[model samples]
Target: MNLLIQLTDLSIKTKQLELLQPLSFKLYQDKPVTILGQTGSGKSLLAQAIVGLLPSELSQQGQVEVFGQTHDRKSLISLWGREVIMLPQEPWRALDPLMPAYQQVSEVYQCLHDLDEESAFYRALKDLERVGLKSSALKRPGQLSGGMAQRLAVTSATAGGAKLVLADEPTKGLDVSRRDDIIQVLMNSAQGGGLLTITHDIEVARQIGGDIIVMKEGVVVEQGSAQQILNHPQHAYTQLLIAADPRHWKARDYPMIEKKPVLEAKRLAIGRNGLALSNGINFTIHSGEVVGVVGDSGCGKSTLGDTLLGLLKPIEGSVKRLSEEAKPYQWLKLFQDPPAALTCSVTLGVLLEDLVKLHQIERQRVAILMSKLNLAPELLERRSTEVSGGELQRFAILRAMLLEPVFLFADEPTSRLDPIIAKEVIELLVDLAKEQGCALLFVSHDPYLIEKRCDTVLRL
Candidate 1:
């Protein structure tokens, strides 16, 4: 088998800290590999180092070779499209929101080969069609589902003839079917170039059916066959990760309290710019209840959440915050995109301070809560741009949790987390919400999560 990518004594360090430590691996054309680790374990960082996509502030040492050839930065400038393609963890950022999906893919084909616009367009369409996105060629990024976007990214990799496919948590937030589709696509594409996927999902690693590389705290701790890693783990962290999935986890029964309505909407219509996306909605959310709003993409789940948060107006109906308190209580939202919601103008310290002041909470109490979430107080000094997506998402959830809102609107709160960590976070949220008697309305696309955690599900 021909080697596709080679890393020897590779380590990456940002200005403040080391991200990856002396990691070495070789990918061959016939055998795929899966790298497993929790959030901030440097899985994504390793991929970035391999592809020369790491930020300028971060520095690396050691050798990265493609097809046994080591190319310097100046010479490696032209190596990306032809030799490597990465399906980013945040697929939303990998694409052009302004361009249609098919067009963006066509541009990839056009850039790498001598194809006319007409030919490229048809080729791109065929590529996407092969990944089961024939109907999505006309849709923009915002219009496509998370799964569809990932498939399109895969199509671009295949079209570009990349020798080594790199995927970072490709199935993080997708549903069961979507995850299967992505894994199958990668497996099929690996018939030519080997695939290396970085993930936190043991299930994803198992399905990929490849050698497993287990990483922890910036170092590789174990490497073996995927099934061997799952069935007979060598490292303690590896055992913890495999054991933490909700499938194997046995959650303690949560307190389901019977209480009056904490939030209600009547004859509601939701949309922006006077265009209604969903209407005639009526629902009552009581304290200690998880009202899971499940739906397909762009079915007004987020619109309803925004309207409830008062960020957007309920076009035609009235929303009442029927809290048990005398003073008007606040409603907090766990946004789908925390980075976008958390402004970059100020440091996170300022944001946390502002939140503390607004809620009249002590600084120490906030610090304690941050500690419980494994979020450092030092993160307070960093901006959203510096935080990883999982970290940002957890920070967003922590901020909302500390506020103790009478009603909490969560938009895919666990989307960026792995199933194991996601399960822990969900349990914590449910327990805290139950303790506070807070009304929890979770807007999510994962039907499995909604079915398992939610007390009442409202499907659209």
Candidate 2:
């Protein structure tokens, strides 16, 4: 088999902190490989290392070669889009927020060949439709559901001709139907090159249909066909991973928790440019009540959020915040990718301090919040890009809590997280909201979350 990528004694470290141990693997131009690991096992770090996108603070000791060319951070510029493509764990990070999804995806072709706007957009539309995001072409990254945003990123990464594709959790945040289509797209794209997918989703790993590498603590414990590794995993960690899917977990009903209405939307119509995506929507969120808004992609779930947060105007309806003295972040909204809601250029420290400055938050209180959210104090020093999604989500929650909002609008808050971390974050949100009597407007495609966590659900 012709080699597309090779790693020789490759390892990753963050200032003496070993993120990945020395490991060797070979990827052929026509073969696809799945790397399975638990969260924090350095699966993502390994992908970054091979792609030459590791942060400057992190160091690597090893040789990485792509298509017979030795690669380092500087050397990658010569072969970026044409030879190597990386689909990040967080798709939002890979996309440009300032541009619409269509325009950003169109740039992929513009990079390789000079094309007119119409032709680039035509190609963008075709590819996006393949991933089920053609309808979201005009939407910005912020306007899409987590799953939609992920597909948009796929459209870009897979657009340019490349010899090898490295995807980290590409199927994350997607529903079962879309997940299958996306897997097929990535696999079809790999017909011309090597496809190495790093995912915690065992189902995703299985459906992609290829060799599997079981990783634990950055060590390759086992490598074999998907049938052997998934059905009969040799490694203990691999077995654990295979058993960790949340889809099989039975949903339990919970007693409803409801209180006085904190916010109410009457006859709401959500849309833009004199259009209504969904109309006649009426919902009321009571303080201490967890309300789930469930719908399919393009069902106006996020549009309702924008309308509620006053980010989008209601074509014909009214929204009332009963709480007096409305302040910033009071009706706080958390999207699947919270970092997009933050200022990418600023450090977490600067954002946190600015938010809590008026309240004169004490160090002790800050520590308490961080501890509750399971975040390290040092994370405050890093930018949004440096921290992982779960870490930044915790900080986003912390920032929202500092504002002491009467209500919180969470749109796909836990969709991007791992099964275990997702459970923890959702539980934490409920517990914290109950403690503060802050109403929750939860939107998710997972029906179980609505049944278990929310007191009542509003369907669109």
Candidate 3:
């Protein structure tokens, strides 16, 4: 077997965390490999380390051989895109916010082919169309939905002409229908080269039908064929993953409040470019209520969240926050992907402290809120990059809660979390609304979470 990628006894150490302790794995040409792990299992760290993007302070030991060449610290950086391309979980974060999506994709092609603008644009458009995106979506990353942005990332990575592709939870935010399409595309790439997928979704792994490498904490606990691993998982951790599927969650009655307008939107027209998503829309969120807004991937859920937060000004209509509380009010808007909303350089603690100071919140109150949210105090010292998606979402919620906002707008708050963690987050939101008399407008496509936690359901 021709090995395309191999890692032997690899270990990485950060100041506060040890990632990939004595990990060993291999990816063969024309074969797909899936790395299964929990939320903080260092799946992303392994991918980053392989692509030579780990920070300098994090010491890496052992061997990382690619294409029969031994790669150390210095050689790995220069060797990244020439041989291996990584599609990050938060695709839009990898994009240049200022550049249009078409231009961004064109840049990847230009790096590989030295093509002129017109040729690059034509190639980029073809790739975009291949991914089932419309030509009009040539707008910036901010304009695309979470799923669309992920497609863009895949298109861009493939365009880079790399022999191996490393995708981190590629289907995390995609809807059921879109997930199949993206998975097919990824499988096609594996047929052409080497594909390494890091995901918690066993169904996705089974669909691709490849080798499996199960990781726990920082070690690979199991390795076998896809059929063997899924059909008969030897490790208890892998079995636990199979059991924790969201479908197995017990359904409970979601409490609803009396219709008293806590927050009202009158003829709200949302969208960045005068392209109204829901024209002349009107809604009211009452105190002690949790309202869910459900729709297709790009159907303006995030835009609605932005408008509610006063971050995006509506073309026409009024948003009124009706709170009688004398205490300073805070509005926390949790993004679909925490990386998009959070700064990479700042630690979680510094971020919380900044929010506290910005909102003039007391330190003691912030401390109490952090503890209540189940976030470890140590997380405050680590940068946003160090935290997992679930932790970052919780941290974002805690920051918002620190200000004691009367209204909380959560956009896909549970998208990145596992079923249990997602349930816990929903419970926390319910408890917060009930205990603090705060109103919540939660947005998600997961009908189960909506049915379980929402006090009122609104379909967009």
Candidate 4:
């Protein structure tokens, strides 16, 4: 039970915001430590600081000791890839999109061992299979689903031979059934070595069944075994989080309203490279209805949404616009991981403005959309890298709204949003879709969200 990671008086600060303030904790070898916090509370920042991936603009103070050795900026830089590895929140960006999935994991193995590419490739494939991914997924990140991408990231980090693995919101966007599978993979990694999982989901922490540290505003509010803290949460924040669990949605009854069909998929078959991911799928979304599609990881829920949006061409059947006279409503697709979709080294405002200009929409209308989406007008000038995941997701949706498509396809739109904000976004989308007669197709694995907002459910 020797300490593998120790943080004493750790503080991280940006120009306007303090991420973590006077944080301290110790993580032992072969044990899992879950760091809990609300969004923008520095959970991910702490992970980044530990793995030397924190942005340069964020100044740090205090000691980060790994393997009983103190790590400063220099030591941390030297320790990365050997002693520590990070499974970032956005797995799509975490891996090089250009590299094949097998190569992505193999590269890590190659960096850590003396094995040739052939051996490393096989080892990577084994790791993927262990995480429930098929051997064929080793070809590309774009070809994988949200859950598969996450599994690939976890396998890559685990195969890297790092003594301490840092996973940020590892199961954030997974469906309930898949969440357990991903958690098991992370816990297995800890059993194999050590792990520090930073997450907002209490269920995830409980599943890990390890030491737990609750954080708020960059501070450790509670620390103890998962059994003690989760069962008898001492802090108000912890209790609030537990109460806010999305799983509670099953108990609440939502208003039911009759509406006309706005979008229809008639035996649709979606594929890429002559491979069908979604075959013979049929579903319909009404003007006010939010139809949710749920399935296991890589089960083609996202592929179905992509096909509905005309982003992916169907191979056999067609997705028809049933509402012929429906108003030209805007369709906004919030990605499962926003950073991957919003990155360009450009300011958030510039991207929005460009979209507005491309659509020949008035700038004033763009400002209004941003306000409706709860984004700061000033964020226009801020670089995409400067914003949080929730903000970026909302911003992307706002940008999409400017186009005014009649059908809206939201793919895990609230994946990065806090529970409260996630609820707000869901409500807003439903209201907007109903008010404007827009057909909405929302794809998520979270059954709770579907139960709350959807008029119909489709199991992929």
Best by TM-score: 4
The lDDT of model 1 is 0.80
Could you say which candidate leads in lDDT? 2
- Ten contiguous residues minimizing lDDT sum, candidate 1: 324-333
Please give the lDDT score at residue 96 for candidate 1: 83
Per-residue lDDT value at 311 in model 2: 91
Q: Give residue 30's lDDT in candidate 4 (0 to 100).
A: 76
Better of 3 and 4 by lDDT: 3
- Over the stretch 329-431, how does candidate 4's per-residue lDDT look in tens digits? 4544667667778866888877776776767889787777777778888877898788776677777777666676567788888877776667667766666
Candidate 3, residues 401-422, lDDT tens digits: the string is: 6666677888888778865567
Instruction: Give residue 402's lDDT in candidate 1 (0 to 100).
Output: 78
lDDT of 2 by residue, 246-291 (tens): 5545554445455777888999888877778789988778888889
Model 2 compared with the native: what TM-score?
0.77
Looking at model 2, report the run of 10 residues with the lowest lDDT sum: 247-256
Error of 3 at 116 (Å): 4.9
Report the C-alpha lDDT of model 1 over 110-221, residue by residue, as the tens digit: 8888788999999988877776777778988887756567666666666777777888888776656667877887787678778999998777899987699999889898
Model 2 off-target regions past 4 Å? 1-3, 13-15, 28-30, 38-40, 51-83, 89-124, 132-149, 161-163, 172-176, 231-244, 250-258, 320-330, 340-372, 375-388, 399-405, 445-448
